[model samples]
Target: MLVPSCENDGGDSKIDIQYGAVINIQKSSSSDTYINLVALQNGGDINLGFTIDKAVGDITSMDVVGLYIKSDGTTIFKGKFSTGIKTFPYTLNINKQKIYDAFTQLNSSDDFETGDQLTISAELTLKDGTVLKLINDDGSNNFSSNIASSSTYKVFQAYNVSCPSELGGTYEFTTTNVKAPTGESAPGPLTGTVTFEDQGGGIYNISDASFGGWTGLYGSGNIARNVQLKDICNKISYFGVDQYDEVFTFSNLVVNGNKISFHWENDYGEYGDTTLKRTDGSNWPALTL
Candidate 1:
């Protein structure tokens, strides 16, 4: 059990890392076609994002511009290769709502596969009339594949957010070569911005101050909520304990996050695994066209 912030006389426990508001645009199923927005921590970082699990990169190099994603409640373009944090000249934060909505409107007509490469190479003409070039170690190609993306969707980060500034705002999105997978290239490139509203509170504070505590966490911990995802669920277990290289079994399980929450058996016990409850109400929202 975690010590309550109120009971911490030693002042060792702080509170949940506070962060500015940030939005998350995510879908329900890997193949489901819908998305919804959620807020980042209250004075914390935006650590959630979307990933394109499988991509055919030979035809889709970094310079292939005209690709964007609508996850995390914002519209933004991620380069073919990135740190998932930096996309060259800009930082990855949820754009303001006004901009986000506009771009999403334009992209509403866009058709995409569930797991297509999100970025590609494009040409930028400089004031001097020189087209921006893609770089290569051998200087043979203008683009290269980035190491940051994986076959599975991973988190994109909106670093160090705060209260008022990160709230409702606009965002921008661009796309190019947005063609069906069976095609040679995408439907040209679409570059534009979108505007959106901060639909919900941008942050959630788990603090003892709200309840008079002195620790990093303040609320009652739900034993069932110990698991938040599949991996987290796999980590917990209870029964005739056995220490494998890395394994655990949990009892009375609960999962939390986004909208959906549930659990089952820990791969042990009799008719066992885990189960879910809708006590908190509402499952994660959907976003897809």
Candidate 2:
């Protein structure tokens, strides 16, 4: 009888793994994440500091650039920074003059406005001449899931341009017109007291966006309370959805003295025109659509 026997063979399989460098951000270095236009005009600067993680790869040097992302999805290359970095930990002190100069180089006549964003990204060069970037040219991430999930590994930093806003207070709301979903005219001439609570960053929470018009037509429980107003550089706009999951749009907005009058219509054919007057005798800022 022939017995089949198995012999152990020394065979092995190996996998090669590559690791990239990471930018460990120190969030405590930057106080605010948005650029205050008022402060920038007053000679303020954007401060950001980070360190390269040498534990992953042999990173020799890093080059960083600034990008201006407009509100209309337009991206412009601002300029590169003179980091003068010779060590792992680096601090970037970007002054307002540098930003202004970069913007002027692109468009001398245009100025930085609200609703714009500024992003700083970097490219790391390895000792073997391999360059690694965490952000793509189109402002997208190029890191893997594991790297993206790391809290300290930051690819880029962005700051939004905004103006100081203080439009929150008590107001007298007067409804001039109201229309139901059936296109039939509803009861108008509604008046009430509303409150605009400041939520910071140019956002205000209205007590009732419809200003008692929806309550008069649909009752108190059905009135819209989830409406918000955004004031970016005095440009007023609507935010959030109503109780019925309908989005609202404002039109014919006029600001005169201490009064703000506008016409609002929802996606479901509900519309109302209301005038809000400040009850505290404070003059409202010049607001536009």
Candidate 3:
């Protein structure tokens, strides 16, 4: 818990200062097919943000600290703000190379694996050299508190993973043309079969996609697809090459059990929805295309 702002108790007035940090995970947008993760070995960059709420004194600089610990209480990585933060709601983009160095320093570990947890903490340095640390009831600044909202995050190696189990096998699909340009023929009820091949780690590849008579923007061919399951919002994403050999991506799909549906629009203002159902009980071998 953070100590509430208090001033003037014994006739001596002192400024109350509060600060904290938040780990921001990038959210997927309509244009984003997958969320990218900074590989531990290859090294990547991620943004770290901070919040400074109450401060009576002039805050000169704030130092943010982070540590990546393993299950054995070993500090695999330790990183800090190379310089003082000069502004509020400050965000720092940290490179994974620095993290790799920290890991090498600990046990000479060359690489990282999944399930690595990272704990971050922060402190404030006032202009007059007054240092205020994140305070907790236990006198530890490791965990998140009202003063500093620190947090631990689990590391994932891959990004843009699709649902492997439920998506595999063949599915019957029905597509209806919802909107089309003026003088364009509105598509009628279309039916087809789409075979999904599991590519491991929640990835699937779709081939032999036939949408009746309605030709897709990509010409009704094979498409690479993935999915991102958020807290409540889920999307079935598609990536393919068009007739012009240009790459395209479309998402905002809803999947319920054996049924999957999505709506898409191109730059030409053509749009429609395709609903899919798995009537055939077929589960292909994992990672076999």
| TM-score for each predicted model, relative to the true structure | 0.19, 0.57, 0.34
As for lDDT, the candidate ahead, 1 or 2, is 2
Cα lDDT tens digits, model 2, 1-289, are: 1112334456654444455666654434445545676765665554444333333556688776677777776666556674434477666555566676655554321456687777776777777876876577676766665565466466677666778788888888889678888765656788888888986557788888888877777666556777888877888888778666789899998888988789999898888899988867788888889
Which regions of candidate 2 are displaced past 4 Å?
1-34, 46-69, 74-111, 117-160, 183-185
lDDT, model 3, position 115: 30
Q: After superposition, how far is residue 150 of candidate 3 from its true place, in Å?
A: 47
How would the candidate models be sorted by lDDT, starting from the highest? 2, 3, 1
Clashing pairs in 3: 162-202
Q: Please state the error at residue 188 of candidate 2 in Å.
A: 2.1
Q: Least accurate stretch of 10 residues (summed lDDT) in model 1?
A: 207-216
What lDDT score goes with residue 185 in model 3?
Answer: 42
Global Cα RMSD, each model? 23.2, 11.7, 15.8
lDDT of 3 by residue, 167-210 (tens): 55667878776444553544656677766675433345655332
Tally clashing residue pairs in candidate 2.
0
* Candidate that scores best on TM-score: 2
lDDT of each: 0.25, 0.70, 0.44
